[model samples]
Structures are given as C-alpha cells and as structure tokens.
Target: MNSTTIITDTHTHLYSEEFAEDRNEMIQRAINAGVSRFFIPAIDSATTQAMYNLEQDFPENIFLMIGLHPTHVKENFEEELNHVTKELARRKFYGIGEIGIDLYWDKTTLDIQKAAFKTQIQLAKHYKLPIVIHCRDAFDEVFEVLESEKSTDLFGIFHCFSGTYEQALQAISYNMKLGIGGVVTFKNGKIDQFLKQIDLCHIVLETDSPYLAPVPFRGKRNESSYIVNVVAKLAEIYGLSEMEISAATTQNSKDVFGI
Candidate 1:
C-alpha cells in the first residue's frame, strides 16, 4: 500500500472481543495498510469501557461514538438509554451511533428498537454529532423513523448500507452517506451491482470487522487491513485506482464525521 494513501474506516468495532487476543497487532496491520483512521461505534453500556480502552491505546487514530445499539434494546432499554444519555452529558465523542432497527435478530423488540433509534437520533442532534446507523432487515421500519426525524441537522452515515439503488437515493436524500464494506465484494452482494451509479461523495469505507469479511478472506475473521481489498474492489467497480478510491472515501468519511 502507498504510504500517502489514506483510508478511513467509518465504522469498525475495534473493541470487539474477536480481536482481544491480538488487538494491537490487528490495528497495527490496518495502519500499515494505509487504513490509518478508525471510527469506533458503541454497542451498549457493556462495551463502553472497552471502547474507551481502545481510544486510550490509540488516541490519535481512534474516534469514538456513543449510543445504544438497536439489537441490544431489551426490556431494560430505558436504563441503557439513560446510560447513553449520561455518557453524552459527560464527555466528547465524534458521533452517536450504530443505532437503528435490526429485525434480523429479534422482531418482538421492534417497538422498543424504533423508540431507541428515534431517541438516539434526537440525542445525536442535541449533541451536534453525526450518527452511524446499523440497519438490518428493517429498512421500512428504519426509514420510517428516519423520515420522522429528517432535518438539515440530521446527517450521518448509514453504516454497512445494504439496500437497493432507490433505497440508496432515499438514504442520501436524508443526508446520509452510504457505508460501503466487505459486502460489496461478495459475488451476490447486490450493492456492488449499482454502487458505481452512486457518486463517490456519497460513500465511505468500512470493515465491520470480525464480521462481513470480504471475499478471498470471506468466512474468515475480518480486520481493518482487509479494507485494502475493499478499496481494490471499489477501484475495480468505479474503474479507478486503489489510491483514488481510498482518497475519495476517506474524504467522504471526514465530511460525515468532521475529522
């Protein structure tokens, strides 16, 4: 990788236990590969300290976001939201996110999930921070909440965006930049079919590490270094060079996260 190539991973759970054994090495590999910036998202209170520890370990490279993940929204969700509230009131984070509707895990929590998503969106707006959304098998429900909260101040990345071109337009219409990740490299991942149609300015790169590993590395553990493969895939998709893809997506990430 070119030393001058700058790639920003807009969403990655560097705190994930999947890398617990070799966390430092994993991050170093990413940095060495030109994936120098990592934006970390909060899962819930359980993962807060881990996130802080990650930042402490790589203060300059890691940026944090605090929020209650939709899939983690349980009966005691009020308490979780309160935790998020307290954290936001307490310190600074680059964004509020990994919050959205996830019907793939549990459909029974739809009502609470929607509630949490909307409340967090309000929190993001209040804090004047960008949001990182995690939508899965619930586009309609997620879009419904986003529609209700649409505003000039409402802007963020639709993390791991996996939707149709029309849906891509809809997300962009709401001031969201699509988070393109490993899925784009999948032979059947539909996003690759029309990603070129979407402007580069509306896109950002991610790994969603320890999950959604790109092809050639598919079914294996994902790490930020693999982001180079995603960059290459995008280069192929857009008929550009890897460095060009890296530069554009990194800039788009800065546009969303403001750093």
Candidate 2:
C-alpha cells in the first residue's frame, strides 16, 4: 500500500448480500488502503438491480459489467440472456462479464454454459466492452470458446484465473489479462510457482469478495480491503514492492476495463 499508488479491485461482488451489514465501512477500508476502484460483475438478472444501485451509490468508484454468469445458466436460460441483452441496449456498462464456463457445480450443464458464454462474448464485442471471464473446472471448454471468438475485439480479464503457466500464456494469446485474486496467496495455490514468468502487464487484482479472501484472511469472508493481501503476494511473486504491484495492476485494470 503506497500512498501514491492507486489500487483497483478489478472484480468484486460488493453488491452481494454478504456485505449487507457494513458495506460502506468495508469499502471505505479498501479506499483507505489505496484500492479506489471497484469493478462490479453481474451474476444474472437477479443481481442487476443491486448492481445498478451500487453504481448509483458510488458512481465515481463503482463500475458495472453486464452478463449472465455461467453457473446461473440453466433451464429458462434464454430468458436470462434476454435480460442481459435488453439491459445492455438500455444503458452503458463497463464490460460484459462474469461470464464463462463453470462445470464445477453441475457438469451436466456444460453445453448450455458454452452457448451462453459465446453469446455473451458476442455481446461484449458488439458493445465494444471488455469481458471478465469466470472459468472454473472448465479451462479446456472456456479456452475453446475463446479460441473460436479470438479476434482483435475479444479482450478482457480472465476473472479469478487459476490455471497452469501454459494456460496463462494461452489466455494472453487471446488478448486476455489475468484477474489475480486470493488464490495466488494460498500455500497450495500452485499458480504461484510460475506466475512470475508471466509479465506484470498481463495481470490485474481482484478480491471476488465474499468468496476468495487472501492468506491470513483465507477461509474468512473476503472484502475489497483484503485486495492488499493479494497485491502483497504478487509483489513477492514478481519480486517487486507492493506499490509497484498495485500501480502496475491498477494500470492494467484501466487497460482492460477502459476506465
């Protein structure tokens, strides 16, 4: 946490119910620690309104992305996708995101997830917005879609990226920036071993709040403020100061989110 380095939580669910009690204070803590920007991702139609309300609350600090998350793609998914498209047409969003293939929860829906993921990638390109992908237990599937959609226009962060070094290179090959989070700080989070080999320009910071809290706070409720822990880990991995990590990643976020 450097006084002059501005930090950005490239992906966070500050609108989540987990912060229902002291959301304001939690955000303030992050801001005080130099994490001034919060990019909020849409889970599905259900969370869109909350996302809007969050943007209104901190219009200057909170940036909203529109998309239907992979895990939420299910029966009647067409209706959900409609909500995403309709909302995109209605207003401006920072990006089209929190979208990708996730087979961890229910492997049965893999096909539908890929369809939805591709549709949203198209939406992102149409809107000229970056995409924040959420890949879980489906790297091969996710990369396949990305490979098909590969173009100068298809670019964004691989949200909560947890993959091998080769996969990291492959993601960058598709014009994606890795959204590093709490996992990088885990002792068994193997990515730490080779993350340094990847350029800092390919990385961005995130908390995925209410989910992956960094070390020391691992297993606890994650908050935007905990992003400092992630930054610290990256500094160690990349052999840079916390300020350098924060500054570079914050700039990388601006590059991906376009703000």
Candidate 3:
C-alpha cells in the first residue's frame, strides 16, 4: 500500500489494555501503512472514557462509536443503556454499536441482549446515526431484530461478518455492509470463497484487532497494520488489485459511517 491510499478499520478496539505499552508505536505503524481511519467500538461504560481519551489524542484519525457490547449486557443493562444515551446526547458519535446478540457466550441473557439491541437501534434512529452491529453465533436473532426495525433510518456495518453467502445477502438487505477482516484471509475462513459474489459497494474492511490477525500473523496479536493482509486477500478474492481493494473498502467505510 502507498502512503496516499486510505484504509479504514471500521471495527477495532484500540483502547484495550492490550496496547498499553506500545499504543503510540502501534498506531504509527498503521498510519505509515495507510490504515488511517479507525472506527473504535465501545464495549461498555468502563471503556467510554478511554475511548474519549484515545480520540482526543488522535482527533483527526480516530472515530468513536458508543454502545454496550452484547456480551456486556448483563444485569445492569438498563443503566448501561442510559449511559449510552447520555454519551450520545453529549456529542456526535459515528454510530451506535458493536451492539447485538452473542449467544456463544451466554444464552441465558438472550432476552436482555435482545432488549438492549432494540433500544440502541431506536437510539440510532433517534440520533440519525448509523449503527455498527456485532453478531456472533446469533445470526438468526440479529436478523430478526433488524427485520422488525428495518427502515431507511437503519444502516451500518455488520462488523466481522463471516456467515454463509445467503446470510451476507440477508445482511445487505437490511441496509448493512459486510465488514470483512482477517477471517477472509484465513485458510479455513470461508468468506473469501464467495465474497467476490458480493459487490464491493457493500463490503468494508476491518482488523478487529489485537485479535483475528490474518495468516502469517494468525494466532498472534493482530494490529491495524495487519489490515493490509486482509486487503491483499480481498484483492485476490475480488479479482482486483490490492490498491483497488483498499480504495473500495475505504470508500465503503465512509459510506457506512457517513464519514
């Protein structure tokens, strides 16, 4: 990738404590590689202030999204939602998200998870902001909420989408662009096989980093800079060049985030 080419990690948690020792250097490595725009996803109130702090340090490059992650939606969900409400009212957020269902972790909280998801969707619509969805082992549930809430007002990226081809189409039907990341590059990652069938317009790039690192870096701590590996995989998958994939995904990110 060239210095001029722009890349966006539409879903990343750069504020995680994992980057405490080398956060500055890690960010610079990404910037140097042209992974310029980072849309940070909030897990819950605990990370909200850290997100604010990170964005202030890199005002021009980092974008923030406010929400309570599905896994974090436990007993105090109502209170957490209130916090999300207050935070959005305080300032503009790129989206309301990293929010959705995660049955893989805790099935008992499904009811509360669904409730939180709906509330945040309404919040997104009320604020007229896009939402970044986080769906894991709960595609059916996620699609169901999206179905009930479907409207022109609802749209955002389906972060780390690695579902079947039909599910990809279904997600797009809900006004969501699939967020492709290192999973696309994994040897066993199936998305690469059919991602080409999907149009570039509905696909955005992400690292989901400090996790989901592409092969060669797989099983290792991933970073935004490794996003180029994803770009290379996408280039191969789409029958386009690396530059083409980078530009297309970056533009797709702008479209979803309204950046």
User: Which prediction has the highest lDDT against the true structure?
Assistant: 1
Pairs clashing in candidate 3?
Answer: none
> What would the TM-score be for candidate 3 when compared with the true structure?
0.99
TM-score of 2: 0.98
Model 3 lDDT per residue over 27-74, tens place: 999999998999999999999989999999999999999999999999
Name model 2 segments beyond 4 Å from true.
none
**Candidate 3 CA-lDDT value:** 0.92
Worst 10 residues of 1 by lDDT: 1-10
If scored against the real structure, what TM-score would every candidate get?
0.99, 0.98, 0.99
Once fitted onto the true fold, the runs of candidate 1 whose alpha carbons sit more than 4 angstroms away are: none
Q: lDDT order of candidates, best first? A: 1, 3, 2
- In candidate 2, the residue pairs with backbone N, CA or C atoms under 3 Å apart (3 or more residues apart, or in different chains) clash, namely none
- lDDT at 192 for candidate 1? 93
| Tens-digit per-residue lDDT, 62-170, candidate 1 | 9999999998999999999999999999999999988999999899999999999999999999988998989999899989999999999999999998899999999
C-alpha lDDT values of all predictions: 0.93, 0.91, 0.92
